[model samples]
Target: MDYIKLLFALLLFLVGCAGISPKPLSIDQRLAAIPRKDAPLEHKLIIRWNEQAVPYLEAGSDADLAFGLGLVHAHLRGGQLALLKRISQGRISEMAGPFTTKVDHALRILDLGRAAPQIEAALPDETRRWLERFVEGMNYYQANTPNTPPEFSLLGISFEPWTVRDVITLSRLVGADVTWFAYFSLLSERRKGQTDEASWRRLIATTQAGAPNFRAAENDSQLLHDLLRASGRSGSNSLALAPGRSQSGGALLANDPHLGVQLPNFWILAGVKSPSYHAVGMMIPGVPIFGIGRNPGVSWGGTNMRAAASDIINISDLDPAGFSKRSELIRRRLWPDAKREVRFSSWGPIISDAELLRGGDGETLALRWEGHDPSDEISAFLGAARAKNASEFIAAFKSYAVSSQNILFADSSGVIGQIMAARVPLRSTSGRASFIRTLDEAKQDWSTHLATPQLPMQLNPQKGFLASANNRPAQTNLFPSSLFSDDERVKRLEELVLSRPLWRVEDLVQIQTDVVSRKAPALRDDLLSFMPDEATKRHPTFVTQLKSWDGSYAASSRGALLFELLLSEVAHKVYADKKGRVSNAASQWSYLTAYLKTDLSALEPHLCKEILQDALDKAAKRADRFKNWGEMHRLPTQHLLARLPILGGRFTLADHPASGSRETVMKTYHGLERGLHQTSYGSQARHLSDLSDPDLNYFTLFGGQDGYLGSQNFADQVPLWENQQYVRLPLREDVVKAEFKRVLVLPN
Candidate 1:
């Protein structure tokens, strides 16, 4: 009776625990609790995951094991997403790939025409096992690996299962691979005829949509069908699928992404601990574990870089009058495909196919990413996540994967570093920075370029710091289409780093969080001009706040908010037209003023208006607009996941979320909220990083550690991150251990 009274009192103290409190449970024990093969999707998912993944998570790092719970939740929720990813064989065979297409064609036959006969007729005698493996692995892992059980915790930091629906919230985060518009060709192309004045806005209202099962075979099949549209006379391309790394530090990354976001955005957290090492980070469901994390001696993080483009060629349509000049038809392969059928649940052949690009061989190629080959990005990251030095980390680099990212490393040995890690295609110049792009293998070896380790750098610079704002590499001057903005940001970083020595992590954090006017120093003249001493009476109070504050743009600061508002108005009018007014990168805006000084007379009327309209508007309504940045730069998850036909033919789209706050991996806004544009959504995943590293971390869609809705973490870290503030990445505490409430031991 006395003990019961004490226990009851303690419950209130620990009231924040939303789910079942974890008790002591071993890997084998957790596996034993789930039923084996033939179990329902939910149960089969449980058994497969607890059987395989739990062993890795439990055996790996502690925080890793905790984060693994997100994988676990994904698996548990896999029934819907997985079932959705599965598609009809008819949809794929029409796709025109032999090995995969034939197998899928047979798979549909087996289902509709009956299994034994279909297999006998369609697949070779030896490959049935491969098909089985694919089916089983896809279903089980999708539903079970990222499982978040129906439990919760009060202390927001730990790993816990997600509710069935929370797993659905993972979509916005999965689409992070959109590369930067690197070169002036691409940038100017996107920037061409672009309005001088723009606002960030979205046509679709996405605040309440559900999730999609994109990785499922059905989804992949549908994706292939969609790719078939441009398949005519196109060549097929495939990657070697091997992973590589920098020659420094030990780091492993499990860079799984959480694609769409609403109230809460999430990923699994797992912890692996041993005296020699401990690592924690995220993992993806329906796939092997990890893309980024930390090991004992090394800590690392990464961002995306698209490094594929052709060699150099300066070809001109010369001598058009004569047929004697052969139209330089370089011999090569081109991938092409025939028209295909797509099975729509309600409408047959929902999406028609067209050949997109043909290879030199006139063969059609699949729409696969360069790094998506069965590579070891996970293993490479695992190796680097715990690396102790440059030498050891380079070894880990051998297995790195996914879209390219600029990795930054910091070790316990008082070393700080950065590496633009990716297989950037090779380049050649006609003795100048600007040159034509070519695909001639004889002259340029784009496929065999050196690793990211060989790129430019300030290795252990005199100043104890290194930074990257997705800028161009240090060794080059031209902003190649293969990469972007590296030199500008890199130069700026070098200036700041070399400016000071012995930077405290706090100082680095300040640098990482710096969001003041990248254009402010130049704007001083423009601002001062408006600072009529007598007219100062009409000056908004926030202007005074901005003038008094340091240049840092912390999210919650009044000055940061004011600047964001000013920019939002500008950005909305400049690009994507999501926000609809003004919101260019502060740094770019700074440069524009200089350009304006020299080119104002040559500027288009629209461009002229862009420069003056924003300051004019803010100056006129500084008090209202400058109240706070959040007013213009909101932390809203704009798109919702809804139904789309194909695969399970059931899923939602997270609509156009563009140009948001800086903390957001990619900024997003739709003209105030459903601004001008088409109604459909856009799914683009640009940045991928888990907060395992301090300097260059990608916080949550909502920012930081946990993203359980209704919990403090749901929106708790938004402002901290929006303002570029940060929460601590907790190292293991002595008391924190995996303690399951009930132990169920299983056979090894």
Candidate 2:
């Protein structure tokens, strides 16, 4: 779908159109104007702001650090933090427009708002203290600030004092099992005509954990839209090469988490110093601690395990005897005065089931997801943030009960490993059926957990490195996980890592930006074999370009564009009847591979010529305008309001031509529309940590730290990020102090 449509929907989601745009707050202005009461206690610590507005927080105690971190967040990212909390608690509709009604309904069904309290209660006292202080910091910032955060002001919403539960709710959105997999699973099943109870059960029993792709589509289902809006491609590259393989004689870890491009960016960088912990890395706005950063001895990064943490069950018939139903009043933005009752069954949200169904089949589809329950997800990563070594890191994960993460750990002690961490469910005989039908089939529960001892872990493998990019857990499985990403990315990563005997932080960045498409080589070879002499002669430049191409989707390479066009055309022609079956290039490759296995005639000269000609003609029209791939394959960071055509320029980040394809190590996946690939989803955060010097961390978020349009930090990192140029992130107090631009000393 075009971004304009998305923006239109977003505009509706934000609220009824208000022509008012809030003036951006200058960083200097904000810091200089800090109220005395809101200022940090004089003896407590110093809060330094860097030139980029990244916080360098120092405090006497961990609690104080957390408090200062909260203040910094409120000062810079308070609007973002509040938005996340609101969205998680299904309150987006309260501030956003009527468009968010379905999303709000979906959230209410999952009951994240109610579950937040439970999650908060599950946190250990120590963790709770850290969290409480963080909230207090935000509340303090709010209480003292003379003006609201710019985003909040633009939306005309007043700031609310945050609770610990709000923080829990924010963390849960990241760690929860809320996925679009269930909807896709059911859609695939329905497409297969397996609507019958017995067929449904059989399908569920037959299909393994890695059954659904969860591909994006134009579906009117609110669940689909909400999930698509809230989430991006759930994959990342996290690898730690042991000291043996590094030139520095220290393990090097590289991590790039691929997610949807959002307004104001998702991850923010912060440097924290306190008596108990002093570290620097990315801090999720609402959550405490440096989420994916290095501590003193150990550095950790994570990739989505993409585990089968959810299933959709078709409850065609329910027994009235034992079932219970609950009704909740839902007030929507469109009809603020009106209240509607939404009914829910014990299984899940029945209202969503009705809304999602195509026809009134009387069959209720219940989403049984891991995230629906109250969890200690917040505690898991927080514990990880405090971990000192490999042993501690592993132990910390034992408490992780949210969605699975393929965690890669490397420490100064020369320990490098990968651990599949999450509350992996050991499905029962019936529960093993990921796609279930009927109450009988869904009755079985997931009682046994995949214990820490059983979870997939590789400690300093002989190869001297451990990596995961949403691939299969291991050669052997502790529990069946849905390996969504094909081994293309991991294979490329392994190739790059193994080929380079000695790895450096720069080498890791190169790998992160690697764009060599695995499928391209084979596809090019096949196309060359089928190219007619006459057509080849007519398009000599095109033929030559293909022959000499290295297969990297670099912006300047005309071959990459031509190849992509041809591939898309051929795939569409071959699978025109089977829509959504071979939509992606990977699926196209699979189809082409199968066809090649049988006969070569499928790609004979005539059909190949037609596909190539069509692609060439389309390319010729656009090729004259673009000098390099970047011009066409522009990566525009999204701002919530940027979707509007006129205001898009304001919300959109300065364009940087991004390299890499869907299958590349860089993995810049985007929508291919209007003969150009406009990047929408890709790496949101990239980090390279040298265990030799924990302070020698190279990291970049897709956007700057500040979400407020007024702050100078907003979109400040785009140029560096676009060029893959990483600024040094100093974790040490001395280094931060040296580079510090401003200081705020709190009063005791």
Candidate 3:
């Protein structure tokens, strides 16, 4: 289907006109429930008067939903968009309106650049101007949303250049399993710079116009709106905008957005009012809605699940005159911009040279790829914030403009939504577009994309239960997981949680917090493949320790001593080429086979000498010199606390921070030492967000409260986040009432 068409369908899912009911906790109660008590209210500060009163956020008897909603509403109106939403709702929160029809226009064609402007130019000038406003709305948020830090860094290790945008974009490029934004950027800076940052930035800007591009939202399911408007006669179902009550008779909505860890882990909260709606969220400074907020009965969040390539470019030593002329032929065909210009700093190919080719000279060649993905990476949240049910919730998904995410929803209607919504490209095994997994680059080709209709979903299952441990889908009917099978995190989540029944949100949270390492069992199984009989029995103590102890890498365990020995043995054999430097890009099996020789050596000084004898025999078949894996593949971690040459240099690669223990998270940031790894840390920051809903319903980041560490609410949360943990945020009015901290009124 056309990418635009899918977007049109998504756009048509926006909420329809429905009257919302009013529900609010007392003014005292709200104050007690504030997520950060130290941060003073904007209204309370004499120098900066709040435009509105905070008490009216949920003001029931006095609420006039329409009285406040307007096209232009923000701090000027006193409350932020999230606060406005707290008081506003229609009889129902439906997703349907003329605005969606315009969305369908872009969805009708795959290339928004080609379709939107051409179609709009043919329209009356006034009509075109009206349409541009909404586009401006999106850009406004993108440009103005404060760049905040993630709630915290893990292990005292913080990423320096890992932008919130990089988190969302990389998630789209790499599968959610990888977290190497800063790593990739640091290592690939030379090549990415060779590719040209200005041109790349411009290319990204074009996709932001809400146009339907293959890269914009992968396929159409990620589009926020569909280009095809559902005519009145079309009779398609609309998202249920009416407030829904769950079995407990409580209004519900679930949102799990994917974002990064930054100084500020979330958007700033602002209240918005319009004749059409009242909502509150981090209004993002200039944006009209609270991207992550709730109107009494509705609220939302996101979790990253973007899918893309995770490989790096490799350099070669072959002279231009040597071997295959096909390299020359391919370069000629691939790069037509022989005279393309390169700005001072760049990566890969020049923008003017759309045709990327291998540049010769002893210098080396450049390549491009999707980097690793992270967990936090969502660009937008407001549309879903207003959704009332699964269908409408999906409509909000139409804007799938942000990064990849698996959105979970629950509403007062007892309806629930669990959708894997993202901009995942269909790649072949060789790392290019294709329907089949073929490593042959010559055979790969882009396939037609899916539309909003193609969304991967499991709504209101008969089991009345759903969970996401940031894993691939359990519903076998869906396409291949954006991730691979070897991912330990996903594997564990599936084994422990999906194997059982999950009914409540707590069940899901339990699975998420599961830090138990089943790695010992997996390693044991790998070891079982070999018997002790294979040992030479020369080192009685070595054999005794291996056989008697369980395979555990606990910090204090001697097992780590053994494991480190194995690593050293294996690394020494695989990384040492003829020059004694590192270079083992050959077959992984060769490295593994050579490393096994070390284990044999460890067993007996000479009893197992045959393993090395056999490895030497195998090397005769290859042209390259020998090397060890450890010499070439040192664990490269983005640790901020380290001060080694490889660890402290703006971008280091020699020594790794600390990893490889099954319990410790580890990922490969592939690239050679040639300008590889510029940013030592990484591009992602993570934080689990939840509003003051008492249920851990909100998350945020950045230098909130003007960078104040002592007085700002944002400051206190930083420490908890630095530890990769969370604190409570109860949204109950009663809780707020009892511990009432402070209150201010937002004026309309």
In order, what lDDT does every prediction score? 0.32, 0.66, 0.29
Candidate 2: segments with Cα more than 4 A from true spot: 1-25, 33-43, 178-182, 185-215, 219-233, 320-346, 351-360, 427-447, 528-538, 578-628, 644-649, 671-674
Q: What digit string (tens of lDDT, one per residue) describes model 3 on residues 435-527?
A: 112223312322423323475676766544454433444443233332221234444544554455322333333333333345544443333
lDDT of 2: 0.66
Backbone clashes, each candidate: 205, 13, 169
Candidate closer to the true structure by lDDT (higher is better), 1 or 3: 1
RMSD of each: 15.7, 4.6, 17.8
Better of 1 and 2 by lDDT: 2
Task: Give the range of the ten consecutive residues with the poorest summed lDDT in model 1.
Answer: 233-242
Best by TM-score: 2
In model 3, the runs with Cα more than 4 Å from the true position are 1-302, 308-380, 423-447, 462-485, 498-510, 524-715, 718-725, 730-740, 744-748
Give the Å error, residue 9, model 3.
53
TM-score of 3: 0.46
True-vs-predicted CA distance for residue 605, candidate 3, Å:
14
Error of 1 at 508 (Å): 6.3
Question: What does the lDDT read for residue 20 in candidate 1?
Answer: 28
User: What is the total number of backbone clashes in candidate 1?
Assistant: 205
lDDT of each residue in 1-748, candidate 1, tens digit only = 4464345334423553433233434444434334323422221111112111222223232232223333343433332233222322132322122323433432232122112232223433222322233234343433443333222232112232222222211211132123211111122222233322211111001110011111112333334322221110011000000011211221212121223343223333333443334554444432223444454455555433333322222222222232211111111111133232322111111111111111222211121123222233434554565567756776666534334555665554545555655544344432222222332421353334445555553445443344444433355622133223223233444455455533333344333333443444344344444333443455546457756654443334555444444443443343334434222221233233433344444557556555545543564475353344444343334211121112111112122222223222122212222112321111111122222233232322243222222222223444544444443222343212232222221111
